[model samples]
Target: MPQRLFIDVHIVQTVPPANVNRDDQGNPKEAIYGGVRRSRVSSQAWKRATREHFDTTVPEHNRATRTRRLTSELAKRIVHDTKLEREKADRLAGALLTRLNLSQGKKASDTAYLLFYGNAQLDTVAALIAGQAHDLAALDDEKLAEAVKDLPVADAFSTGHPVGVALFGRMVADIPKLNVDASVQVAHALSTHETQLEFDYFTAVDDKTEKEETGAGMIGTIAFNSATLYRYATVGFAQLTDNLGGDTEAALDALDRFVDSFARSAPTGYQNAFAHRTRPSLIAVVVRDDQPVNLVTAFEEPVPSEAGIQATSVRRLAHEYAEASRAWGDSPLHAAATHTFTTDEPRSKETAEALTAAFGDRISFDELRSGLRERLSAVLEAQG
Candidate 1:
C-alpha cells in the first residue's frame, strides 16, 4: 500500500462586529457546541470565499466555472472556435451535453443543476465538436447520439481538473462517473468562547426631507456578533497529487495557494456595513503521515476572554495541541507556524512562547510555504 499524507491548518482570527455569514433569517450563523452557543461561519461560505480568492490569485487556465448554464457557455465557445451559426452551435452543444447523461433544465440551454467544469475541459469539448461539426450538424438527434456514442465526451471532464475543481470537487448525480471526490476538507469556523447575539438599531434620514419633516426615512435592526474564531482545514496530499494527474510540482503549487487563500480570504457578508476584515493572528501547519486531525476539541471547554480572547485562545490551542501530540504519539513529520502576535505585552509574550514551544520556532509566512513545499517534494519523490 502507498503511504498516506495530509496537511492540517489551524487558525485563530478575531472579527469585529460583523455578520460574515448569515442564515435565512439574516443573522450571523451560530452552532451549539460544547453545550453553549458559539459564533459560526459555515464551511460553504468559506469555500466560496476561497474560490473567489482563486479568481485573482490562481491562473485562468487553472480555474473552473460553476454555473447551471453550461450549455450556453459551451455553445458560445463552439461559435467562437468554429464560427458556426448561433442556432447550429446551440443545437450541437446541447446534443453533446445530452451525451454526458446530464439532465436539461426547463430551458434547453440550461442544465438541471450547476456544473463545475474546468476551462480546459470545455475547450477540449468545444474542439471535439468543431472537428465533427460537419457530420454532427447534418445528423438528427437520433443519429447524432449513435455517432458520438464512442466519442470521449465524458472523458473530457473525468480528468484534467482545474485546481479549484480538484480541491472543491464536483458531483453529477445523473452520471456517477463524473464525480470527483474533494481533496480538501474545511471546517466551519467557531468562536473559541461562548457568544451572545447582539443587534444594531439605526435610522436613516431622508436627505430631501422637507425642513418641517423630522421623521427618519427608514428604521431597522441588523444582527451581529464579535468573536475570536478558531478556523481549521485539511488537505490530503496524496489525493491532491492524483487530482493534478500526479504532477508533484502542480500539487505543491496548489497546496501553497490553498494555504494562502484559506488564511487570507474573508467572506463579504455585510462587509460594507461592518468592514470586518482582519488577518489571522496565528496560523499553524502540520504535515502528518497518518490521518488528518482537527484540534477544535481543544475548545470543548470554552476559553475565557476576560483578559483577552485572541491571546487566551492561542494559549489554549497550544496546550491542546501539545496534549494531543503526547497522548496520540503521532508526532507530525513537519510542523511550523507564523503568528502576528508580538512579545511586548505579557499575554502576547506568553502566547508567543506557547506557540514556539508547541510548533517549532516562529517563521515568516514565506519561509513556512517554502519549507512545506520542500518537505512535500521529498515525500512525493520517495513515494514514487
Candidate 2:
C-alpha cells in the first residue's frame, strides 16, 4: 500500500465568563448549530495564538514576519550593514522590491499587500543592493529599472524555509510562482452547547476627579458568552514534508511544535477584564493512513443539557468515534492518543483511556509525541 499521512486533532475545552473572539459590533462571534445559536472563536484568532506560542516556545526555529513595511524595514538593514546613505538605500530597496511587484505608493514607501517573509529572504535582498549599489546608482532612471529587471529574484529562497513560512505558507499577488499553499487547515471553534449571550456593564472612575462630580469616567456594555468549545484542525504530513524539502527530521519537529502549541494556546481577547486562561478538558489525536474524519456531526443535534454538557459531550464523542471505526474498519487508523481532565463523570461510560484503547496504545503526552514520530518514520521508510 502507498504511504498515506495525515493528523487530525480534536479538542473539547471550557472557558469561563470571557470573550475570546469578537465580531464587528463588539459582540462575541456566534454560529447556528442544530437550529440553536452557539458561541464561536474564529480559526484566524486561534491560529494566531498558536503561532505566538510557536514563537515563544520553539528555540532556534527560524520564524517569518508578516508585515506591510517591507521596503522600510529592508532600507534600515541596508543603511546599517552597507556604506550607502539612508536616501540611497531607500531608493535602491524600493527599486528592487518594485521589480518583485512587492511595493506600491508614489515613493513605494510600503508594500501593496501584507508580505510574509523569512529573515534570510529579506537579508538576501538587502545584500543584493549593497553589493551593486554604486553601479546601480550611476544608471539613468530607465537603465536602473532595466538593471533590476535582470536580477534573479526567483532564486532568492534557495536556502531552507523558516518554520512559520513553511507551516502557514504565503502568497505573492502578482507572482503566483512565489506563492506557498498552507499545509495545515484549521476549523473555526464552535461551542458544543447552545449559547446564552450576556452583557457586562462596566465603568472606570477617574483617579483625579472633582469631589462633587456626579458621574464617573467611562461606561460601556461588553458582550460575552461562555460554553464548552469543540476545536478541530488537521496537519497534512505529506505537504509538511514537501514544504520542508523532504527533510524528515524537520517535518517531525514541526509536527511536535504544532500539536503542543495548538493544545495549550488560547486567544487573548478581553483577557484583561476576564482572564479565561484554561486548557483543554479533553484532547484526541488521530493519525490516519486514509482520509481525515471529523466527528463534529455527533454534536449536530446538540448534546442534551440534562446531563452535564461537558460530560455528555465527552460520551457522544466516544460513541460516535466507536461507530465510525466499526463502519470504516481499522485500516484507516494508524494510531490514536487521548487526554482528559474530567475523569470521574458518572454519566460518561467512555473515559479518555478507554476510548483511545482499541485505536492505539494509551500513552502520556510526551510518549505520544515521540511514539507517533517513530511510527511515522518507520512507515515512510518502508514505503520508500
Candidate 3:
C-alpha cells in the first residue's frame, strides 16, 4: 500500500452570481449552476488558492525579503563599473532606490539580470559588451540546458537564498519533494459550487459542544456579507506520492497548518470587509491511509475515524457553512456544478451532469429543458 495524493476539493460556499461581468474582450461571463451569479472569488480564485495552500504553488512562496537584499549588492556593482554617479546608475537599472519595491518604479530591469549571470565582480560595461537579451522561453530546453552547463552550482549543504528558490520554481528546476506526478496529472484543478439542502431545523446546539452556538439562522435570500469556510482537500498517501517521498505526514500536516493560517487571515486588501470575524470555521487533522479506497461507508464497524487519529474532514466544513449562513442571515458565495471544456477531442459532454439524474428518475432532461423553456416563455410573454 504505497502512499498517494488523492484529493477532491469541493466548494462549500453559496455561489452568488456576478450577475454580469465582461471579459477584457467584452464577452459575457458564463453563468454557472442554473442561472446563479458568480462571486469575486470565482473558480479560478478558489483553484489558485487551493494550489497555493497545498504547498505546490510555484514561485509564490519566494521570500521577498531576500530579493531586496540582493538588489542593493548588485546595484553597487552597476555604479562602480560604469564610473557613473549613483543617480545615473540608478536610472540605468531603473531603480529609484535599492529600497524601492521589487517591481515598483522601473526596478526589476537589467541590474537583477546582471547579478543573476554571475557578473557581480564584473563591471557593467564589460558585461554589456558580452551580454545580449532575448526571450529565454523561446530557446529550446536542450539549448538552455546546454547554456547553463558551465554555470557553477551552489555550495553543498547550504541553505540557499530566496532567489535560488525562485529560480528553481521558475522552470529552472523542479520543486524538491513536490509530487509533480500528481500535479502534472491534475494541473492544480479545483472547482467550487454550492448545493442547498432545504431543511427544517427545530433549533438546537450541535454536539461539538464546549462551544456555544448562539444563533444558527434559517436559510434565506438575503446577500450574506461574508462566510467562514472550513475547506478540506484530502489527498491520499498513494497515487504515487513520490516527489514527496517519505514526507506524506509532513506534507499533510504542513497543508493543514497552511490552511489554518489562511482561514484566520483574510487576503490583504479585504481584511476589514467583514464585521464579525471567525477563525478557521474549524480545523481538522485528517490522517489518511496509504491507499484511499471509496467504500460505501455503510454502518460497518467503524471506530470513529480510528479513535480521532484520522478525523473525518468534511463535518467541520458543514458546521462552518451553517455558521456563516446564520451569521450573515443569507447564503455565502458558492459554486454549483462544474463542467468540462473541450474542442474537437473534448471529454464527452453528453454524459455530463443531469444524465444520471435523468436516468435515475430524479430528473428528466426533456422535463428540465421544458421547465426552463416555460420560464423563458413567461419572461418573453411579459416582455411582449
Question: Could you say which candidate leads in TM-score?
Answer: 1
What are the per-residue Cα lDDT tens digits for candidate 1 across 290-366? 88999999899998758688888988998899899999997798999999766777657888889989997889888
Look at candidate 1 and tell me the lDDT of residue 231: 98
Q: Which tens-of-lDDT digit does each residue in 294-341 have in candidate 2?
A: 878878987665547886676567677778788877565455665553
Instruction: Indicate which candidate wins on lDDT.
Output: 1
| lDDT for each candidate structure | 0.89, 0.78, 0.29
Stretches off by above 4 angstroms in model 1 are 132-135, 138-140
Which regions of candidate 3 deviate over 4 angstroms? 5-31, 38-149, 153-253, 273-277, 280-384
Instruction: Compute the lDDT for candidate 3.
Output: 0.29
- Residue 148 of candidate 2: its Cα lDDT? 89
Sort the candidates on lDDT, descending order: 1, 2, 3
Query: Which pairs clash in model 2?
Result: none
Query: Which lDDT value does model 3 have at 107?
Result: 50
How many pairs collide in each candidate, listed in order? 0, 0, 20
Better model by TM-score: candidate 1 vs candidate 2: 1
The window of 10 residues in a row where model 1 has the poorest summed lDDT is: 340-349
In TM-score terms, candidate 3 sits at: 0.32
Residue 384 deviation, candidate 3, in Å? 72
